[model samples]
Target: MVSRIDYDRDMVQLHEDIQKSKETPIIRKDRIRKSNNNNTNSVHKETLEENIKNANTLHLDNDIYSVYWTDTIPDHIQESHPYIAIMTSNKPDHLDRLILNLLKNALVDPDRILVFNDGVDPVLPILEKYEMTANQLVQNSQTHTKVKGDQNQKDFYINQHYRFMFSFIFDRLHLENIIVLEDDLVLSSDSMGYFTLLSRLMKYDPSIFCVSAWNDNAYLWNSIPDEPLDHLRFSFKRQNHFGGLGFLINNRTYFNRIEPAWREEGANYKPWDTVVQNSMLPEDSCIYPSVPRSQHSPILSRNYKAITSKENEVDEWSFMQFYNPADFFVDGKYMKVYRMTMAPMLQPEYDFNLDRSIRASVEIDSLYAIGFLTTSPHSSFVFYHRVYSDKDKDWELVTKILSLVGIGNGGVVRTVYEGVIETSVLGKRLYIVGFYSKFVFEKHRATKAKMKLNDLIKLVDYGNAHFNEALTKSYLFMLENDHSLHVKVAEQSESCSTHCKTHNFSCKEPYQILLLNSGFVEYSFTSQKYCKTIKIAENSESELGNLPSLYSATQTCVLPNNPSKISCSYTPAKNENVTRKLCICNK
Candidate 1:
């Protein structure tokens, strides 16, 4: 809610000011208004943390500036002077209101502007139309990949929304802390004030995360915090803050914690959001609050792209502050941003095949086994119920839970399944242990039919025949249970059989592939069994030392299809003398 000075009256007057300023095409900037000096009206009732941030910052200046813009500027807010950098994206449809509203708010404070083409061609024409200046204008086209039968993959790249948002945050906006905004995002009139307060606050505590704009409530408070910091502050990298419209992150923190993970997840949405919300960090990593100070109410609506002057009466514009809040705040000024304690983790009802089942639909060659539960038939195999990896993901849940045991005791939010362990042995051959496909190219009915006839053949149920060939030669595996599922790799002239290609060995008796089915298999078996199986990553860093692999004891039964009592030392013997060591793959 606004502490109103008559918004309607202000708008009318503003519109009149706009109409009269046609000569300048409606310049919008928070012109340095003379300072508000009534000569110190009252004493400050300073909170402990508040006093800390304020201690370093004396009210050195009191000038205010506001910019008013015409309603026609498109996609991004244009700045009058050079900026740390500019940020805008292709959003042609909302050009009307988005442009104007942005201009109005931006006129508050800004340095420079960076506009993206909104995926449009001939962007300069629009720039010319808006009378905008850009420190840089990034132009590129993005094509969405369409995946059949995959909701997970649908617009999987759409999360590039952050990549688009970050362009300025990285190369352009190099302040100790930076603020990011989206076209359709909403702001609190107090947004600027909050930023100012937070900036000053961070001085004392380098760990205070530049708080975000959205709050999901789940990350609030858990155990009654033990410290007397006064303001209830939670771990920063611990909470689940959703990043869509925007959030502020400290430069140091971004480089240290976020960069690596963001690069790894790269624009995958829901999962990416979950990852961010769950990223792990030490207990002292402070979050002012997890919820964002702003929201994307308009953008969340399907008609978000349609927010233009043609639809709403706003224009494209940006702000230039009397100063970036960075100057006003200190590093450790904690505040009562969050008021509640965190919730305890509740393990779900026991059926562990969730992860196995999620990817089983795509039959993708490899996936991380993120979940597990005890169930019938399978007893206990990994499932996709839920877990976090990719280091940058949200680990607050883990941190908070661990805080219960003791501060800083929490580890990364990952699955503690009976079989998997984070280890050096898998030697970067890290992967999830879940049931994927047993037979490759299931559609080759005749060939597949022949494969099913022999009990020694394994089956992988990837729906796509095209990918099946690659899946068999690649991909890691896990037996679903202790009974040791039987497999029979039939021959090709046995024609077209998945097993006939390169597996040079055939089993005379049904046997199991040593997967995570038996409790006996640990991280090392999983690693040894899945080495060098996946194709080298097409691009990006391909960790050569650990390709996927498969491991199982060469069964006297002729097949290694079951999760039986086979074993490996898990530790690679320090001695170079152990060539015939009980390797998991050769178990």
Candidate 2:
């Protein structure tokens, strides 16, 4: 419904473009919803109402834009579980605006806010004016650091500020989690509470390394359905971008793992955000909401002041929906993927023997067990390669099934010989599983001969084989007998088919009637970095039906290397009625 610029621009500019230089909307007492549903303590209702009434009477020009307020401290807040707001800034106005925003909208204790001042501008006056005199504000006016007098120096200063903030939070305060922000950002009404919930989730799951409040895909805000906003938060292995604007960090990971790793590398040449982003554990991800909780207020950031001119851009979506802890789910799909090592590992038989005579018959051999292992319930497929020297002096490689383990603790194995063992207890079956590996080398002929005469060489040979162990042995025991393997296999096959059908459409390639964000169906692709947004007319079902049949079309988008052409025809999804026809084509 809203028109956006073709080029990527700041939110302020978008606001200005829409409003045409109108005065900024002032916060009014009536605009404040008289409810504590916004994660506010009910006791704050009276105090907030009085404050709003007083502000309205004063007719303040730059009133704090808040839709809700509360004075009743939450349990986490009352227990001194204050979230330290670490802000890096040289601009006094920026710092003042950010602190003002926090005071009005954030749910964190104001006393715990920390400011790392990079400029000589006295921020304490600003703090004192905003009733933040007790705030822990520190300054790092380091001018002696050898600067090449370039952008690199500016980048270095940014990292230095962050280093100082992290060190203070890690060693001095010894806090576990912290909310960090750039000075030129404003907090949404629900930001502090949102971060609190995310921090709690981080404590519960160690795999979540960071929690971001800024969404890079905010441009697609219109395409998202607002109804599901309260229920979903995307868990991504890769972030949309470096979230230096607003993010939560686990100080344990920062101090124990990331800081040590950065120092070990001499902390040279890389951006601070990049250092932190790359320092996450191999299997961890940063979780963020589809809708962002913070708005980037600075169009011309201090570091980028050289590139962008000072322009007042209007921001329409500065305020967003309030979210609560009880309505959010953290686990979701990854937009881009990283290494997934959780897949099963398969090893069918032993190797490194000179003789192939020990190989089992086809019926008993584990190689034939691939089918049973892969199709087993709650399992992931793994590929393994094995090499062996045959009696004829030829080397051969074999691919075989190593093991089948269930998701979590459902599948079990008792012995390597019996892949997934199932035992019936009365009428129920139980499963228990374990995976183990050992190295064993082929016996030397001379040692074998000497062992026949003396047992001393046999012990030495055993020691050598034990040291060179080359095979893995797995065992699993059935813990429950209620599940039938045959039924599971059938269900898994059907599930896999459905999953494949649902996710088969490639986002990069031309998709046949692919659903985009929310209910928008992508009927075409114009070989561009971003897709153009269009709206469908309010046509009746009868008018829309056969509309696609009446028209066939092709579109092209210009690329640097070549032009991309997309063809389309009216098509509906499987089992869909005639009114649902849309432009769809596939390569």
Candidate 3:
């Protein structure tokens, strides 16, 4: 627990620092000064030769940055515990909060916690106050200048920071394992313990590259607070992407594989994390918690808010709504140890049959299913339609479903694990299998079969009254509020499917095509329930022409949930002047 006085003082100092930073120009002189003998409690003075012997030097851009340590590095560093490396960029307030949180919750020696400051001096005071050790790498003032307005330059500098940090940790510090964190994050009480336990798994399994403490889709809406302890907090899954926040990485692989292939310059340069993800071997995968132990605290820094706002063109902050600090949890240190010991034997076997798997999931109280695209040409469509309706390709609908059932969006691809896409719907786990898990499902290829949409709905709808109502209400709400619903004049040569996809949506099959004359009156309804259902027809312009003249003469408005209300007749309307509009109902 951070005391109010400490927090307040830190905030005040942070404000003053920010003001000073804006007013002061970048000083070209070296910022790394020799420690004064006056502050013995917070600083340790050492000769340059001693620094090299202790591996307390960071070489960056042809400059040697001396690492300041509050206490001497132990001669025998424990292999069981990892060095916690925190990266910060002038965010003193965030650094303060993070350090306080770590002190209060993390079961690690303060000497093992290392801070990497990216050419920022304001963080020094906070570090000194806590007597925490850090390495301050100062690039030329020009590098800092380039970062002010150019995103690419900023990315380059950030990549450089990681390069320097990694080199210092693995090459200089001679440490085997490290837990990486950023300043704009707060840890759960069990964060350090979570990583400590999982590090053993990484040691046992060479295929596992990293163990992450973040779940990309662990939003408040997607989390179930009252879920069983094991399924809720202790669950783990293989992740496709490298989740950066609070992740543990070892030095052996870094030196052997990642270091040589690391991107430092050229047109190929990208974000450090992106480069890491791309460089991962096909067999490589990250192990991540089902629920997050570390969360992004964007509100902690004004700079973070400013950067995110400028980059909001991509809707980066849209997922912020799903983040609730209270959702982060870890069962306990004892349980973590037990789970770690049992992890090797707890790996699940793949279920190839969708129907059988779903049935089994229904019987189990808690489950996760990962769906994969089959070799069949229609596999993507079939899986899409069955899990979610074929009406639209909106990923948000899939997200909402997962949220309602209490699940995280495993990573960026949402509900994806070890390349396999995962979600729970109607009390059953569904997976759209990815390439990496082919070994598990490919052998059982002959057993794989698709479940029809109607059959799936029926299976879940049969005695599960609560799930039925919840699913219906949620589905209906999405349909009613869906903005993709639109009217388009029927094209002579184009189909509804092509048209809908043109607008980046999936067509609601059996499109409602309405024919009305100039004098036709449009029907109006206050509620979706009052909206009339129309006859379901094939994807043809002539299907709706069979409707009665009276119905065809008047303009019709149809809601997505209601069935087609247009009464069909064998006779085609003789009226040639009537305008035809195709209603594309997409969710």
Candidate 1 achieves a global lDDT of: 0.30
Q: lDDT tens digits, residues 197-269, model 1?
A: 4444344434344445443221111112122221212222223123334455666656655555566644255
Residues 440-513 of candidate 3: C-alpha lDDT, one tens digit per residue: 23334435554433332333322434334433423332223345444443332334445556666654422231
User: Candidate 2: which stretches are off by over 4 Å?
Assistant: 1-81, 143-148, 226-229, 232-242, 299-587
Candidate 3: which stretches are off by over 4 Å? Answer: 1-80, 133-146, 223-226, 263-268, 301-340, 345-415, 426-428, 435-450, 454-587
- Candidate lDDT scores, in order, read 0.30, 0.37, 0.44
Candidate 2: count of backbone clashes, pairs at least 3 residues apart or interchain: 35
Sort by lDDT, top down from the best = 3, 2, 1
Better of 1 and 2 by lDDT: 2
Best by lDDT: 3
